[model samples]
Target chain A: MSIKTSILSSIGQKLLLATSGLIMFLLFLIPHMGGNVLFLFGPDMFNSYAHHLHQLVPIVIGIELLMLTSISVHMIMAFRVVLANRKAADKRHTLKSSKERSLAARLMPVSGIMIFIFIVKHLLDFKFYEKAKTTLHGVETYDVYAMVLSRFQGDPVHLVFYVLFMVAVGFHLSHALQSSIQTYGIYVPREGSKIKLISAVVGWGMAATFAIIPIFAFIK
Target chain B: MSKQINLTLKVWRQNRGEEGKFETYEAKNIDTDASFLEMLDVVNDELTLKGIEPIAFEHDCREGICGCCGSTVNGKTHGSHERTTLCQLHMRHFEDGQNVVIEPFRATAFPVIKDLIVDRSGLDEIIAEGGYVSVKTGNAPEASTTPIKKEMAEAAMDAAECIGCGACVAACPNGSAMLFTSAKVSQYALLPQGHPERAQRVKNMVAKMDELGFGNCSNEYECAVSCPKGIDVKNIARLNREFIKANLGKN
Candidate 1:
């Protein structure tokens, strides 16, 4: 009984990870964009919203932990599947052949890893560092929202990195969503066509939403 | 209106095994109403008249049903149109002065046997590796007894239409046989007759597909795109799920 469910669970696990990953990405992005809209009220309002999150420290910490775990599991499973495919393909030919799959599917693992690295840097810059240490402006616990925006605006380095990271995220979601649907057994022509369309729209939406924040931050 | 169209053909020529090169020929004014394969017939007839060996290619039903006339024409499989096969491809798609590049199917498993003809037995090898309904025919109950849903039946039929041509493998950059083998597996797996060997079938077929020097399905779907019979990539997806379930010891 235990083995049976676990076996079934492995198949579900990948779909679950992908579904939850996509949800969390969209959830965080939508609200994050909404919060950025507060920038229209000036940097102070944005800074104050960041302070409110700090005040709700317990809830913030809890959500952070959950997000971290979800992300880790998703990344691990995705990487495992990618590695398995690589090994499976390699064992067959022995001689390396050029990519025979679509460009999107072929580069999924590399793109995913890049997005993962970007996420880590993102957390360190805005979330952890600001929470752990004082800012150079002599403010304790940091003015994270402002600090982030200022980095994008004044630092060309940060702006370029953010844009590149968003592009990677877009491509990752585009391929992952389409392939994940296929992975889960929804491959009929009609459904497959719908999935492809939805994946493209969602992927572009994610990249655009993320890009909006950086663009606004740069200008303001 | 069937306008007369003059076209130059650049076709891959090979006398025998493994070695082949492209040879160019000027096809005189031909009726644009002819099917792409019919146009090829004209060239072959002219070659025979001149005592030159006619180009060798494979085709069975010219109705796009046999899946035998698989080739890359002008860089697209089965000609430029989507969901169209070579026999179904008409000369109307080409311009008068256009140069058509005709080549044999290319893949590690599909070795070229002659000019524009490849040995696609790799597909059969994968299929035989376990792409079947193992249930004994006489011992089985009535077909209506199982009562499968109409949708599933239709989907199974769609997959079953795959004629084991290696066009999907040729179109795919990775030479993945996932579409071909998976469609075969899914066609049977989707049906009631497929129940007995469900687990073993997917496992054996997938393993065989990989062992035959085919690439893993990355879901680029070029296989579905170039399939002359329009075998959907969904079959490949179903195959993936079936394999994962089998590997994990689930039915």
Candidate 2:
């Protein structure tokens, strides 16, 4: 890309990643999460469901690829925007001082990187390799579903990590989702307040949905 | 929770020029439900009927939509209430026999024009720099033609709600116009209508804001708190992002 195209495309890419990520989380991730917490329905039911999903190899692979690409684009654009913001701010201050960004806003880039890594690990452990599960009865069974459940029920460290990650995701989404929509310039005058409310609600849904998985496992 | 109140109003009084003084006036039997501007209106009416220069202040749209009514009332921009304009602030916030101090909105860019009216024309100039859609007529398309998502549309509108009030500058310790300018920049930059001149717009607006001598936004949240429109500081974050993208090159 030329300097001009890259600059414009960078903004375009950021908008795409942000808006897509928001929809993915709100419409897909939250509902998926509701179905993922299988302790209430027992391991057998959840395992069969997982097996059935695994049977759709091509479709699942396609989705995973699309998700990976989308997520990578989101992270790359996020870091670029954050760096550029800092640079612009520094120039304005001319080495005299710095602009004050909130702790939550400032932490977005760093927290985003962590969340990116955690997401990869999450997909691998639960959906891809079943790495969380090891040899079982000399059969090399990787009960992907059970591995996720075991983390909350048996592994305190994993449970804690899960909860912490969810909280970070909540904070990130609160700023990111609202900001991304703004960056893209899509709201109407009459609907502005409703969108703000929607942003908050989506943030809460992400936090609460992700939170439920760990809490249910830990308690039951 | 209502009560009759007596207030000692130390309002700024000046005939002309930079020289001015806080003249005390007793406003008795003040209704607690009355807005701060309304109370001032009552006082001004009394002054007007008495053949005096009715306290020489500025106000418009006492409904709080217009950003015209602004002053430093008791050390707070737009009065003590958070995210409120002077018109929205009611007397019930204060007690009877309380001393209320009212002064002009002080800032380098906002020079005092009269008793309470400050020259906010700087903001207008900054807006004129690139705060508009440059798309030519005859080829202009409908807004609905763009398939913008509901989420992005809302954010842009929120930023656009900023009524050109300099409260953000007044609230800033550095006297930064980032919040105000950013809101203007973001509203356009976020939309496709602003795409043609996006890079130049941000760069030019920032340059103008700086040329106008407004301070930097240090994220004090005071601007957000004091903003009658409640423009969030997140727009500043987006502004920083837009500035960076703009500086890289024009697309």
DockQ of each: 0.19, 0.02
Question: How far out, in Å, is residue A74 in model 1?
Answer: 8.4
Instruction: Judge candidate 1 against the unseen true structure and give its global Cα lDDT, from 0 to 1.
Output: 0.73
After superposing candidate 1, which stretches have Cα over 4 Å from the reference? A1-140, A188-194, B1-4, B14-20, B29-34, B48-53, B137-149
> lDDT per residue, candidate 2, B110-173, as tens digits?
7777888878898998899999997767975886788887778898999999997788777665
lDDT of 1 by residue, A23-116 (tens): 6665565566677667657656766776666798898777777777778877776765455444433311112222334455666777788988
Per-residue lDDT of B248 in model 1: 70
Restricted to chain B, the TM-score per model reads 0.95, 0.93
- The C-alpha RMSD of each candidate to the native structure, in angstroms, is 6.2, 10.8
lDDT tens digits, residue span B45-109, model 1: 99999898898989999887787887878767777787888888888888889898888777767
- Give the runs in model 2 whose Cα sits over 4 Å from its true position: A1-220, B1-3, B49-51, B138-143
Give Cα distance to truth, residue B43, candidate 1, Å.
Answer: 2.3
